[model samples]
Target: MPVAVGSYGQTQPSCFDRVKMGFMMGFAVGMAAGAMFGTFSCLRVGMRGRELMGGVGKTMLQSGGTFGTFMSIGMGIRC
Candidate 1:
């Protein structure tokens, strides 16, 4: 039998590493979308500068947490 050799002998990331990466990516994307939505919603409701900042902050936190949790759970199940 012939021996099989890897091209560069590089190992792939582990399941845990991939799950962590997915969680981080999901959180980042969720936070960005939340910030945009919060800004627009606040503007539509006539919220001013400071209020807009607060709204965006709150939305980003909530969105990040929610997405992170869901991603972790999903990845855990799959992995």
Candidate 2:
């Protein structure tokens, strides 16, 4: 299925609200999956991804605290 996208993909939105909805929905699912994978070793990429997911989950619902989370989930990960 095709995902939605706003103009330039900014969160404030521009075009596809479906993208935002999908992102949020997938993000939550990913957060759960990531956390589940991290129950063992923090040194592993899976663990790191899990931690990142948890942080992002909190940030999205709280309206803040995403600075560190953003950095963690930056352009380095490719999995």
Candidate closest to the true structure, highest TM-score? 1
RMSD of each: 4.3, 12.4
What is the overall TM-score of model 1 with all chains considered together?
0.77
| Tens-digit lDDT track of model 1 for 34-63 | 898878888899989888899889998889
**Alpha-carbon deviation at 44 in model 1, angstroms:** 2.3
Question: Residue-wise lDDT of candidate 2 within 1-79, one digit each (tens)?
Answer: 3446667884443334444444555556555554554433334544366676675455444332233244334422421
Worst 10 residues of 1 by lDDT: 1-10
- TM-scores of the models, in the order given: 0.77, 0.34
- What is the lDDT for 1 in model 2? 35
Angstrom error at residue 22, model 1: 1.1
